[model samples]
Target: MKRKINCETARNFSIVKALEKLGHFPKKSNEKEAWFLSPFRSETQASFKVSKTKNRWYDHGEGIGGNVIDLVCKVLTCSIKEALSFLNGDTLFFSFQQQQNLLKKETGIDIIKVQEIEHPALIQYLNSRGISVSIANTYCKEVWYLYKASEFFTIGLKNDKGGWELRNKIFKNSSSPKSYTYIQNNNKQLIILEGMFDLLSFAIMEDVLLNTSDILVLNSISFIKDIEKFIHKYIIVHLYLDNDSAGKKATQYLMNKYEHVIDKSSSYRNYKDLNDVLSYENRKEI
Candidate 1:
């Protein structure tokens, strides 16, 4: 037998649990209220709020208030019936639970040390990639980490979830949670990157990025679906993806779906990605 839930049942469901399926969680919470970064737009502050006692939500940024069903309709862009179907569906329930399990404690990662990015080997590695040491230092940390029972030092880029994306001349991995690294701004413009290296490359190549526009480093292409909700709010979105097949398909899908989406891959038309372009340009100067 199948359990069919009505809109009445959904109206009383928990918005916090509903949002968990959409990857929206409270930045701060208590017994009364839970505050979150607005799923409707990109902003530094947490403007969307949920009332634990009442099981209702209010997005102060967007001036919207509703129950769980309405919240689902707004966030997922689905109609009432569609939203109801999703609320009653098993797929989202399992995904929400799986995400919770994956993010549980974010254990297995041990930080042996953290220091300034000034080591000669690390500095030399940055220079070889044409990255400015000072710029890299602002976004990256020197980390001595343990993985697979072995210890190694690497350049670490912190994700929005407080997990570090660890990279070096050889080792490339991330602490648990594996979330996106969001550089937030109030600007209507948005730039998306596949990795932190590309973000560092953008900072070096473009002089206007002194926190002027919002940027998101997905860290992995698998994050595309997770970040898609935040992308539509941008008036203009520049996709700085690689020249490879996967990047091409992603860029194409995004461009076709959103009129504001633009492929900026042509800037690095001859290279694999923006980092490669930066390296090639730097080599030309040598």
Candidate 2:
């Protein structure tokens, strides 16, 4: 059995080493202290610091500081018990890696062309995700884009801002000016979804040859606040979110803020989301 280490012992553990283990190397360092980029938020300058001698850490941006345990809690966003278990090797913690932000990438995607969905590879990709070619053709387009001077293509779903959400077998990205996608059908009842694929999956599952209600694809949960203006008038709002903590929290937030908000995630509670269930069911049939 793994042994438990108390807070005092965990505190004395080298903060510099712990930060390094979490894939956060110091930008500047001396014998007494080291400065690092804040893991909590992205910035060009290093504002997070670890004291080598005192064995403590601080984030200038957040104005928070504490021992290694506190640092772990902040980094993992977990409780003390969870952090202790994580540090004890009882739970595996994946080292955090900085992801390239599509909105802020230096070599932003340049759309070379946009046309009908005809790529065999893209059709296979959609089929792999249990999305039929007819559904994809109806809702998406084939987009050829240039990134880092290399040509690439993917399935594109257009948003309200004219930007495209790009997805393929390997990479998922979006053009700048990202925003949600809404399809209004003059219906009082609205269906809300996290992504376009979820709506397509729901259509396939329900055999929705004709859309009976208005559709709103948030595209990203960050755009959830923007929904208030569009959703306030709807008599009933159906939420089809992922079966995850963030999804559940967003579901609750909408339910608390609006009337006739129904969570339909229970239909796919055993899976991650609507598309996940569709993919799994497709796999089961084969």
Q: Compared with the true structure, what per-residue lDDT tens digits does model 2 show for residues 47-127? A: 788889888888875577989888877766567876676566555432212211223333467899999888887888788
In the range 1-286, model 1's lDDT, one tens digit per residue, is: 8778798788777888877765566789998989976665333457789999999888864467989888777665457886787777644422122221111132455788888897777787789899988999888899876545666566888899887776655334467666898888788999999887888999889849536789999887667778999887889999998787657888998899889999999988898889898898899999
**Sliding window of 10 residues with minimal summed lDDT for model 2:** 94-103
Evaluate model 1: give its lDDT.
0.75
Q: Alpha-carbon error at 208 in model 1, in Å?
A: 0.5
Candidate 2 stretches greater than 4 Å from native: 1-104
- Evaluate all candidate structures by whole-model CA lDDT and list the values in order: 0.75, 0.75
Which numbered prediction scores highest in TM-score against the true structure? 2
Instruction: Please provide the root mean square deviation of candidate 2 (C-alpha atoms, Å).
Output: 10.1
